[model samples]
Target: MKLYIKYMVSLRCKLLVRQELEKLGLHHISIELGMVEIKEEITEEQKQGLKSNLAASGLELLDDKKSILVDKIKSVIIEMIHYAEEIPKGNYSDYISEKLGYNYIYLSNLFSEVKGITIQHFIIKHKIEKAKELILYDELNLTEISYRLHYSSVAHLSNQFKKITGHSPSFYKKLGKKRKDTLENL
Candidate 1:
């Protein structure tokens, strides 16, 4: 059975979730961001125990189809930003649809309904977050980062970053305060 989880974003979170399942004597076949597939269906008592334990850690087990779809979309974006070495420049709609094996319209509508935000907005938000990460690492200049993320130009990236974050990328880097969002929200 595939179980959707909230806030299972980082590698550390994946390990933590794995540890929690082991503690509860649950055998999981695989674990990934925002989800896990267990070897067997969970009993009601086991579900409740998991719900309580995960809630204490600020994670929730998701059950509904729409919510699960939303998590799947978020998971794809997170993986792309955090792990993918390169993303091609093109219509991301087709790319995401192909990657997730769902029609773009279905994914977009479901995501907006569950998240109260458009998928494009979510992507932009995460792009800004990735920009922050790159700038923090000081591995690339603003222009290089802009090209890496396939932004039209540095000006465009700066404009979008300022609109979402109320600060320019350069200013954000100067302040050096780490801004972040929860994985579910991001």
Candidate 2:
């Protein structure tokens, strides 16, 4: 049985889910962000127990198809931003559509309807969060960060950063505050 889970966006989440499954004595085939597959059919009691355990850890098992699709979209974006070494070449909408096997408009509309935020805004928010992380690491300058994130220029990055964060990249860096949202929350 394949279970789609919400808020399973990080390594810790995967571990937590694995632990819960083990505690329930359920054998899982695989555990991935936002989804898991179990080898054996589970009893209703086991399913309820698993759901309760997951909920205690701030995760929810999704049954609705739309909700599952939305979670899939989120997992893909989070993976691209936080794990992928190199940004894929091409427009994000095209990439997302191709990856999800759906039209970009349909995905965008579903995302907006479900999340109350546009997909573009979600990407921009995550990008800004990533920018903050890069700035704090002190590994790359603003120019390098911009180039790495596919921004047109440092000015463009700064402008977007300022718009979203209410602080310019330089100022935010100087502030030295590492205020970051969890991946699931974002």
Segments in model 1 whose C-alpha atoms lie over 4 Å from true places: 177-186
Candidate 1 per-residue lDDT, tens place, 1-186, comes to 989997778888888888889988999999999999999889998898888888888888988888888888898888877778986577778878988899999999889988899999998998899998999888899999999999999999999999999999999987764343333356
TM-scores for every predicted model: 0.90, 0.91
Q: What number of backbone clashes does candidate 2 have, counting pairs of residues 3 or more apart or in separate chains?
A: 0
lDDT per residue as tens, model 2, 1-186: 999999999999999999999999999999989999999998899889999999998999898999999999998888887778977768999989998999999999999999999999998888899999899998999999999888999999999999999999998987774344344356
Against the reference, the lDDT scores of all candidates come to: 0.87, 0.91
TM-score of 2: 0.91
Worst 10 residues of 1 by lDDT: 177-186
lDDT of 2 at 20: 96
